[model samples]
Target chain A: MNAPLLKIDQLSASAGGAPVLHGVSLEVNAGEVHAIMGPNGSGKSTLAHVLAGRPGYVITGGTVRFDGADLLALPAEERARAGLFLGFQYPVEIPGVSNAYLLKAALNACRRQRGEQDIDAFDFLNLVRDKMRTMHIDEALLTRGVNEGFSGGEKKRNEILQMLVMEPRLALLDETDSGLDIDALKIVGRGINSLRAAERAVVVITHYQRLLDYVVPDQVHVLARGRIVRSGDRALALELERRGYDWLLEAAPAMA
Target chain B: MKALERILADFGSPADAGPARLAAAEALSTHALPTRRDENWRYANLRALEAVRTFLPGPAPSISPALPPALPGYSRLVFIDGRLQPQHSLPDTALLGSLRRSAAGSADAGPVPFAFSGDGRFGLIARMFAPEPIALRVAGSLALELISITTAQACGSYLELDLELAAHAQLELVERHLGGAGPTGLSCVQVDLQLAEQAQSTHTRLLQGAPDALHYDTVAVTVGAGAQYLLRQVSAGAQTARSTIQVRLSGREARTQIRALATAHEAQVCDALFTVLHEAPGTRSDQLFRGIASDRAHVACSADVQVSAGAPGARVVQSLRGLIDGAGAEVDLRPRLTINTDEVQAAHGATTGRLDEDLLFYLLARGLSPVEARSLLKWAFLAEALNAIDAPALRRAAGQGAAARLADTPATELLQ
Candidate 1:
């Protein structure tokens, strides 16, 4: 009866004047998780970046709607303030800004936008410490620069820690599990799982099915050549893992 | 050329002129001011100097000027218009007795007891016109604050500081140069530092002049065997500022560290030339400089390190970086290393670039406004050099000063 929380209709995008995504469509409803698995250069990351309003990407056709508003019209920061979070595949290292300072500033910015007062210092510290424990992050990293000199696993964990703090309405994760190890993947999965609620939606983009073992998405879609060629339940991920992308590429042109 | 001639004509040798003062004036009579053709003076804004009408010392203010709050555990000395204000100074009698305010170019102190290698013309000017050169000798642990304030006078102001540390002594010195409300004026400063064997000295200098002022300074230092010298400098004011610094590792195993930051905006020009000579075996030096130019400003830093044949097993490291924030702004960084000996380790790099776009986008993606993001990144870039300061009070003061220059909101919070 209710419209999907996010709706993408015939969305086509290009990067550097080269077409990357062609006529892609998808819908995600609140209280549900969707997994997008694709081979290299299949445009999975492009779709997520386009939805987040990243610079350097042009929407060639169609539209994206988030919470009944035209998402493509907003800037990156405005989209962020409107409760959209993107977990970058490779997080940036900012050497001079402390992790705590950035987290507090971001949280305060969001709160101010919602007509709420700044979070009390004491409360902010407590919340960060609790999330750090859940994400298995060291307490000392809080005072260090944002992901400065962090190991690959540590960077992923920090991204999850930030997501846990912001608690956005919709989270688009771009290969967040690529460099994570078994233990780190579990911690990150648990962090994302905690954000699952009746009013929140999640879209996980990845190359493998291992992350699905922990988060367990409700639906899985196979994207080939910028188009979803197959859709199924969680069993679809297992089938792809067993058969490999060669079988899909053989059948992709027919489906297109 | 006319400015130099005018300065020489205006200087009718005074009654207090000593042999050194006479020699300096005589040298200036025949020596010509350096032009853009000179290698070391190429980036200097010499046009500003040619516009000066008078080279006479600014008259000392009759009333004591307001001073910044004193740092904890540090004795304070105030100088207004090149004249020492003893009433405003709170010096420990025993240690303060060594600070002598001699006559202008007093020869009894003996030609600084150190060799001079920086631009001799400016040193000559200070030697010829400075009211009195303050010489201080330290034989034990002490912390001292020297504040020099230039008033609203149209004439030039000059000061020469002579500091010597005895063997095995420790000293912490904080020097501040501030400009009183005024129009454009010239401030020429010369500092000479000599450290004995096994001695240690930490020097911090802050230059905050008026927006329309001209400032030129030359600092020469000699480090003795097993001695350590550390200098941290921050320049954030003046329409045109230039500094030339040279350090000679005269004794074996001497060590030196120099860190500097220059922030220029709005048609300002800041230039610095730093040189370190390893003359003895096993001497080491590390230098780092960071500069930011915004809104049509220009910033330049040239760092040179040289190892002599006598200095085998020497170590040298130099890192110079500059950031430009506006289309018309310009920053230049040059790192030079010349080694004539074997078995030496030297690394040098220089880079000038705009702010990293990825870093900016990272902040924006977190909901920060464009201005806030830019301010934070700029503060962070300058903080890299400020973080090396060991003194908390000095670091805090430098951070606040830098934040104010960046127009960063809530200076206290930014520093924290």
Candidate 2:
């Protein structure tokens, strides 16, 4: 339905010349949330990076179609301008570039792509003030260099803040809940939930099921050794939380 | 005559000069001009200086060139072609009074006064041929804007400046060196700074020479007990620009900071050398330099920090970063820290590369194209040193100018 916001078929990739994601396939439709739960080294982050067009990741064989266009053919910034956003697991610290500057530039790029004018300075400030409040971030952090010296939880919140401002069509959250505490997790979950709409899609790639508890996913998939072995509903996440991933890997030799 | 001989002939014989000038000339003859064999001149050749030796000094500039607007709240002292243009400066009775007289009298004013010692061949030439040496005894918080303009291509120019600060005094000085278009011949400047106990000074030098000009500058400073000193130098638009800075921390708790930014594009060559000596205990020094080389240009920086054997509790840190974009662009960066005492802390680093790929990718992910990302990262790298400028307005102006100049360089793609 609706051309499936994103469709990946037989996607095989490698990072640093080593095979990571092997023939992984998935489809995400607009107006829906999907959860990918896997153990470490299951190519969870690799899939997210590949979708965002990060360099150093070789696509051995695969196809990623975003709204009926080849996503792999675009550059990183082109992908970003085309409504594809990746919330990095470890937000990079860029010195001398303020957070506000980064967000304004990113938002203007998306706006230009959408045939809209750039936001005025005064209006931009007001908009960010509101987003900061919703994300529980300090206004002082906006003046600081991008992610420079930011705490783990603060960095995650900043990611959500950026996502909110840009409002991309497809948002990929790669382990956004990895180092966040219970309170931070709830805030991030709420920030992400507020952006969910009938015309947007989100893929939450995480190692634990706790994040899914706050922002429940409509579909849950178990990715083992770079392949999606089982696909189910919310019950699958609950079962994975109770049974862990080892059982799934042991039960199916094909997953190995 | 040889190149050095021709230069010496323009200034006449050393016998007619003052003691300092005589000593400088003798030193020049004794120690030949710097050569590639010298470790300090490893990356810079003195052939330009040799080529300009035959150019004689022009007549004193009759009319001063239109100088840039002064930084607000600063008094001006303008010099054109090595001659002081008092008509263009503010009326500082004491300052003008000293300029009317010989500077030799003021440099040797009181006990423990400051003086210049010739350290290189160019220093000697500056002393021997310097038309007018502006020497001053500063007191009671002084803010000054000094402009030195070089005109008349057929002739050369040399300047010698000596300034001493009294105890507990403060000084903020900005020096601008501008050369005429299509310039020829050599321009040499020597500045000696002597800070008394508890004195503080912030010195900024903006050096802009003609695309074909040659320049040699040397600054020697001695820091007293409980004194502080900061020097920020930005040099650009020169065919061959060489700067040497020497500092001696002679008293306890004396602190100093040095930041230098050099941009060399086209066929320009920019060289900076810093030698810091720690002679007393509990002294500290921080040095940083940033260079951008493009289009077959070259930039070189050499920093040497030496702590005496008995100078304990000394701390020193030095960092150098160079951006080399385009084919044949070269950057030679050398940072050395020699600590003779076991109780000292010293760290030095030198890095020369195009740019950080991960940082570039991070910016790209923020929706910046490749060119925009490289420009931002380049500005960020140079800002690390530009932040050392104490004046906010001046820093902002210089930063914007540098960014605009660097924005045109070709972006080196992330081939990695």
Candidate 3:
């Protein structure tokens, strides 16, 4: 933890100049896994998008540092090439571009930024073959267009496959477990765990504690009204599962 | 000078014997409007054609135009003002040499067009200009071959052409019609094709109408035994534009398919009509045409199909769509079916609509500005239709061309 992988200081954001996330702060250290669980409109997805530099949500206050560099100043792809990745809740469908081609493009984009010549086609194929075998994924998935006409489980696993291939320094999984079955969940979790390293960090955003059972996180936080109201170890998620947001509502009126 | 008019008057009066078939035909059809003399000139307005009667015969004016590269792995031929410009290219092959020689010797004989079945401006020019027929003869079975046509003039007379492909040859043909509407220019074309047994062909046309720009073109496709044919035509809003495709399957086990799509802007009119005929038993045909009119642009589209009796295995499918961009854009799409054969599966459908709400929402939610979202959907819709091209280069170029015309949409963000 000499220099934590990502540091967020009093970060605030607005959509159409109206507050969405108000004074949110968090930290993720190398090799650590953090989980953010919240109800709808709790800004869970917004936080993931902001970190990936998606357009339109203006950063109003505070700062975000990823690997010692400013995160807010980069474009979405630039942030990606900088070792930050967001597995979209709803993966896009690029009709003519095959999944393998897209993944390779992303890998090359990242490698090029790090001043490395892109992996040749033969090397890329070999790399993909190995990753697919380990993740229990099939080669046919790579031949089709990116996530096009994919089933719910297929889309989620595709996201994990992307994560496995890119091996980003920081990965954000936005509701990756939402539409997946228990078996698919186990596969995704295994894929994530296999990549755990001191050079990388992970943040899995979910609406329920069910996902925590598969990929245990070192830290858990409850976010509501654009703010993280509670923080604890793995037990915090178990508490939210039993109690819901009832106590947060009871405390907010008096605090106001 | 109206190339057709001034020159034709002199040749008939014997002050000119410059009968380089194309040159001679240009002179004869150069009149102002449908006079009693022009055979194919009755239904459409020739007022714009007449206005340019005094125009000095200018060179094929120098142009600085650009279009998207062809789909990968395909041979390509690009043309400007109906003349194959040196700037465009095609893959090297013997078929390439044959087609070039055929065009120069142009329009060899074929069966006569059934008179009065399809008519107006382009028909007149086609009948009057190329008596022999501009043929695209395919020698053997080949893939990934493409041909494109473009017009970039503001005001000019019509250029009549006859395009034909011989039996046993296979390829993809793309006709791209473009021009400036200022000063009221006119372009007219006639394309004819032939496909033999075990041969396949596909044709795509993209056009926009000018306020005073009157554009008219016709396509005729004939297929032999066990051959396949696919045709699609797309139009943008304009002053007036009309394209008609007539196809027939004569040999047993022959198959044919046709589609037409149009997106019109303000104060414009477009018509995409198709005629399908199954002359023999075991022949099949399918056609779908969709059109959209936005920004107060109006369109009149129709389809006429006839399947001769005794063709027990004829099949057909057709549809049309139109989207009204603004308050004033208008569209008219019609599909007709004629069948004489029993035991046949044939269907035709047409639709005219506004922007699709679901498609719009999906794109906007992804951080694309509203305009950018609309533009992507527009191009995607056209791309799906163009994707049917056997030649990837034709598909890529058509998609890129249609996307560029959507200037208001900032699609430049994702295209590269």
- Among these predictions, the greatest DockQ belongs to 1
lDDT of 2 by residue, B250-317 (tens): 88989999988988777788898888899999999999999998778899999989999868999999
Q: Roughly what TM-score does model 2 have, to 2 decimal places?
A: 0.93
Choose the strongest candidate by lDDT: 1
| Candidate 1 lDDT, B1-416, residue by residue in tens | 58778788778868778887787777767666778788878888988887777889877678657788889889988877777888988888865788876577767644642223335477777777888788888888889988888773678888888888999988898888888866748888878888999999998988887788888887888899999999999988888988888888999999999989998888989999888999999999999999988889889998989899999989999999998977899898878899999999988888899888778777777888778888888877887788887778778777766555553443256675
Evaluated at residue B97, the lDDT of candidate 1 is 80
The chain B TM-scores of all candidates, as shown, are 0.95, 0.91, 0.74
* Interface RMSD for each predicted structure: 0.9, 1.0, 6.5
Worst 10 residues of 3 chain B by lDDT: B10-19
Q: Give all candidates' CA lDDT scores.
A: 0.85, 0.82, 0.65
Candidate 2 or 3, higher DockQ? 2
Give the candidate order by descending lDDT. Answer: 1, 2, 3
lDDT of 2 at A160: 94
- State which candidate, 1 or 3, has the greater DockQ: 1
| Model 3 lDDT at residue B383 | 48
Candidate 2's displacement at residue A166, Å, is 1.5
Runs in model 3 deviating more than 4 A are A1-3, A16-18, A252-256, B1-120, B131-188, B194-216, B222-227, B232-243, B248-255, B258-387, B391-416
| Model 3 agreement with the true structure over B301-405: per-residue lDDT tens digits | 667667788577777666655555667766666667777767878665666676666445333323234575566555555544555554544444445544443
